[model samples]
Target: MDEMPALDKMIIYLDQLAISQIFKIKTGTYPSEAPHHAFWTEVTNLLQQGVLLQQVLCPASDIHRDESMVFTRGDELTLTHEMLGGDTSFRSSSEIEGDQVWAYLRGFVSGKEPILDLSVDSILDGHRNEWLSRLHISAAMDWTGIAKDVRDRREMSADNMVPLYERWRADPKTSFKSVLKTELESFGSSRVTAYLHFAEMARRGLGSIPNQFVE
Candidate 1:
């Protein structure tokens, strides 16, 4: 079983990306050199805005009301070059690209080996306490529900089970048509068609899943 749901993983990735961007904006530098205090300050400031806070956090359900801390009080935030993207020359600058962020996100949800050390204790968890409070809430939403359905209902075979569209969509370097065609040939028409249909639903809005099923 997938330990962390795909949609939840995606939300966490997006939240982390937003946090990194906000950190860069406030400090006039990327997160690599940012202090823990500065990072938390931006998070606190962001939470004060009602709409944007909702957009940024995207809490799914009542679990957001939970007051539990995701990271222990003694936990110290470390700033390291490795965590900040020193491994690959794909991005020479400190700024984390959208494509790189998405690739890491995809790798995370798919259980692929970590490329950038995204362990919960790392910078990704700076908002951990707040995010966990709202984590359960967002997981119950329609978008996440669709992801759950896809995970549960997708075929077991490697040919049909791999989320070709999702993986390709997350990677900027990959060609969608090429991947889809390859998947179609390997998985056959019936299975590939279902994947296409699900991808379409995911595109327009995952909230549309119920309507698509009804029709």
Candidate 2:
């Protein structure tokens, strides 16, 4: 059961890169006197205190945990997420989109405006608000081999996007709308196809219980 966090509470969103920096500091790869190390360490400590005091909400999402696939065994980011992410998470974009789309479809049938809850509270899932529930699984097994793939894809995209970007910028007539209609359609289709393929892989990886997660 999720508690609607105090409306007055500030939101702090830490993406994976920030988490990785903190992880490095934790492992002492960053020297103690390093400015980044000290900065991230202080930031993390303050965020932790803020959460404990309910002065802030550092919400996370499924992608954060999933992206941790890039980290191998003995290199768990789960604990860092537990400490800062605080169990409050946004439902995945797909799930939220599915619900909104379904509601929109229902509006056509009922001939009424779609009644959708767009508030942050509506999307949050506080899996365990109690103090004890934040304890993360310590041991990690089986690196998912995504780090290399991510690096390769990044490098590939960097190489590919430059010319497209230069071409677009050079053409005064080029517009986002035109790009969306012409180029983005294929990418969007591929995105959905890739999501389905990955979902299937996830199902197979989980074996018997697709919804259940074991850290």
Candidate closest to the true structure, highest lDDT: 2
Which residue ranges in model 1 land beyond 4 Å of their true spot?
1-16, 28-48, 51-56, 59-175, 181-215
Which 10 successive residues of model 1 have the least lDDT summed?
A: 73-82
| TM-score for candidate 2, residues paired by index | 0.58
Candidate 1 pairs with clashing backbones: 60-137, 60-138, 61-137, 64-133
lDDT of 1 by residue, 1-215 (tens): 86643222212322334433543454555555556656655554654342223233332111211111121210111111112211111222123433355566688899996477444323232342232332221111123324444434433444554576568668879876887688768755664477579778888885656775755
- The residue-level lDDT of candidate 2 at 213 comes to 68
lDDT (Cα) of model 1:
0.39
> How many pairs of residues in model 2 come into backbone collision?
0
